[model samples]
Target: MGEPQNPGRERGLDIILASRAYDLGFMSDWGGAGNIISTLYSAKSTNFASTWAKIETKARTELANELALFRGLE
Candidate 1:
């Protein structure tokens, strides 16, 4: 009989596929914007993943700050 598949591995693969699809759609719609911003900022590389990580980090930090402020008001 064939070996059983690992559910963890299957889930990981699914996540990777979804991430790739998202990246493709994002690039298709805003790919040129990245280039323009990079040029304006004098960035040497237009790495999508790096830019996305920075944006996500900023968003999370902002959200956390806002939540903390709201909680203090209570």
Candidate 2:
């Protein structure tokens, strides 16, 4: 994907969304550290509850992708 117009500002926004996602993830006891971190980094701050949902979905997708090969071996 292409970078934002202002990468520095976009990075700051990512950090803000990440912190929020981390708190939500911790409170919910969801996913492992890698998933949590990935969700945080990938989250977009469109809204509060919706953003959490997005993070959860992203985390689950990432986890499934990571384990897809193992699952297929079953």
Candidate 3:
């Protein structure tokens, strides 16, 4: 028995990437500040796309954890 993984981590990474992208310039704070208001004032947000492609984020995070455990995060 153990704690389930926090899927919010994936969204957090997405927000970080999105914040830096050209489509979301106004939405700074690295996703810490969330709202359509903050996100709306963008330079050009017509095609706002996230960099962290879902499964990739999960795989990367899981792989990171496994690697850490192998190196003794166990």
TM-score of each: 0.30, 0.26, 0.27
Residue pairs with colliding backbones in model 2 are none
Better of 2 and 3 by lDDT: 2
| lDDT tens digits by residue: candidate 3, 1-74 | 88889989899999998887453322332232223343445544433344223234554555566567669944
Whole-model alpha-carbon lDDT for candidate 3: 0.49
lDDT for every model?
Answer: 0.58, 0.58, 0.49
Q: What is the lDDT of residue 64 in candidate 2?
A: 70
lDDT of 2 by residue, 8-67 (tens): 897998899888634543443434433444455667433545545656666676567656
- Which scores better on lDDT, 1 or 3? 1
TM-score for candidate 1, please give it. Answer: 0.30
Q: Candidate 3: where is the Cα deviation over 4 Å?
A: 1-52
Clashes of each: 0, 0, 0
Among all windows of 10 consecutive residues in model 3, the one with the lowest summed lDDT is: 25-34
Per-residue CA lDDT of model 1 for 1-74, tens digit only, reads: 98787879888988998886344323432334334455436776666566666565555565566568779999
